[model samples]
Target: MAIKAKNLSFSYRKKKVLENLNFEIKDGEFIAILGPNGAGKTTLLKCILGLLKVEGEILVFGKDPSTCKKILEMISYVPQKSTLSTDLPITVIDVLRMNSKELNEEIIEDFELCDKMKTLFRELSGGFQQRVLIARALMKNPKMILLDEPFNGVDVLSQEKITKILEKVNATVLAVVHNINPIIHAVDRVMLLNRELIAFGKPNDVFTKENLFKAYKAEIPVVICEEGIIHPLYGDQHG
Candidate 1:
């Protein structure tokens, strides 16, 4: 198992954020976490990454993620684009070199960041910046990867590109995504969370109208298309 959580729970001061979250992720599985804005989706990722103190147990690769140094090294993380400093005077190559010594030129070219190697990170577009972040994470050659909103704030073209890149990554990936439309086919399973585990299964099983309504606390419209069932993008408007 890449990750296992039992009776997991978290709180901020007095209010609880996550409660009794139980799940397991197998090796090389691409799971997409779907939830509303305050659904503790990011909080759950932090717990798995060992960045937060929780009430229950979480095992990443059969060890406690919070205390195991080896587990930390085996994981790579790409935070949400909002967390990054847009004014920082860093280059694409500089970011990659910060975490890895051996430069994987292939990743740079694959992400279409080869031309921006010398450009300041702040000057690049949001889509390019996200690609650079993904490249930096890949440079670590980790066994598991955690991405928070990998496609947020990017154009449709960039979303398609990132989705394709994710499909080729040979690792267990747990990504927090705003919409499933872009990565519906790339992910192996879908996990709907709202301070609790709402539903977890294949995309066809979990992305139903009932499950989405329960997670979002509102009626979510779902449409069946030639590709598959498509759910409306859950955002602040729904909340």
Candidate 2:
């Protein structure tokens, strides 16, 4: 297993953010966490990254993240794009070099960032900045990756590119996404949360209207296309 959480709960300023969360992610599986704002989507990622203290247990590869700090090196985390500053006068290559002295040419090429190496990080579009951050996160060659709101501010083309790249990664992935349209078909499972685990299973099975209403506390449109893909029309931060 890549991650296991049992009765996991977290509180901020004495109010619970996450409560009694229990789930397991298999090796190499891609999981998408969906919920409204203040639903503890990002907090869960922090807990997995061992950035926050919480009740119960969260284990990475069967090791406690809080105790065994070494396991943290095996996991890479990328926060929401809005929280990252792009006004710095650093080049794409310079930003990447911060993580490792030896660069992976294949990754640079695969992300289609070869031509932008010399470009200033601040000059790139929001899509490109997100791509650069994700590429930088992979420099450590981690076994697992955590991404929070990766698609925020990203254009459709960049979203497609990022989704395609994620489909090919060998490591386990857990992404907190505001909209599931970009990767609804690629992810192995979908987790719905609203201070609790509302549903955890395959997208088709877990994305029922009833579950969506329960998690969002409102009726949400759930659509199934001709290809049998489930699409939740109400996947924004409005709540």
Candidate with the greatest lDDT versus the true structure: 2
Task: List, residue by residue over 1-239, the lDDT tens digit for candidate 1.
Answer: 99999999999998999999999999999999989888899999899889899899999999998888678788899999888887888877888887798989899889988788899988888888888888899998989989999887788898899889888999999989878888888889999998899999998899777888898878877666787666555543563
Q: Model 2, 1-239: lDDT tens per residue?
A: 99999999999999999999999999999999999898999999989988899899999899988888998889888888677666778999998887777898988998899999999999999899999988988888889989999998899999999889888988999999989989998899999999999999999888898998888888888788889988988677543
Candidate 1 accuracy as TM-score: 0.96
- TM-score on alpha carbons, each prediction: 0.96, 0.97
RMSD of each: 1.4, 1.1
Task: Score candidate 2 by lDDT.
Answer: 0.89
- lDDT of candidate 1 vs native? 0.87
Angstrom error of the Cα, residue 100, model 1: value is: 0.7
Counting clashing residue pairs in each candidate, in order, gives 0, 0
Stretch of 10 with least lDDT, candidate 2: 230-239
| Stretches > 4 Å off in candidate 2 | 237-239
User: Model 1 clash pairs?
Assistant: none
